[model samples]
Target: MLGKTASDNRVFVYEVAGVRQNTDNDKNSYPFRSSSSVFIKVPYQRMNDEMRRITRMGGTILSIKPWTSNNGSGEQSNDGD
Candidate 1:
């Protein structure tokens, strides 16, 4: 029962709504919806960087939660791969 806790190294999933591919700066371009919920497995250390990147891209994070496995067993682990 001795292992790294969920908070030790967590991955968050950013549920971003209204994500457009093209920006308004584009000349006479029609922006398209990229995805409804972009599941980005961001590492604990890169959370800020990812948030910045998402904001820069005009994405509004609707919700953020720790990444989990499909079966809801526990936090998903990235074994350097």
Candidate 2:
């Protein structure tokens, strides 16, 4: 999965295997920031579908981050970057 942060600070996660579309406000219900741009995750299988759905809904993807699993396992944060 891929995660993107919109201008409104709302994060959207997608399967990275879909399409991107452009449509009106017919399927939009949530509030999104005005300066939103679509970010896509490539090198995946069938990512066009997810991209299309997000664009059609009038939302933009900002970034993509690696997915992690937190099953109550204690983890440490490293700030050595």
Residues 1-81 of candidate 2 have per-residue lDDT tens digits of 667534323222333222334354334454433332423333233345555555666555554543234322232111111
Instruction: List candidate 2 segments past 4 Å from native.
Output: 1-46, 71-81
Candidate 1 displacement at residue 29 in angstroms: 21
lDDT of 1 by residue, 1-81 (tens): 878776667767667765555553243233343556555566776778767766866778887786766625432222232
Best by lDDT: 1
lDDT of each: 0.59, 0.38
Clashes of each: 0, 15
Clash count (model 2, backbone only): 15
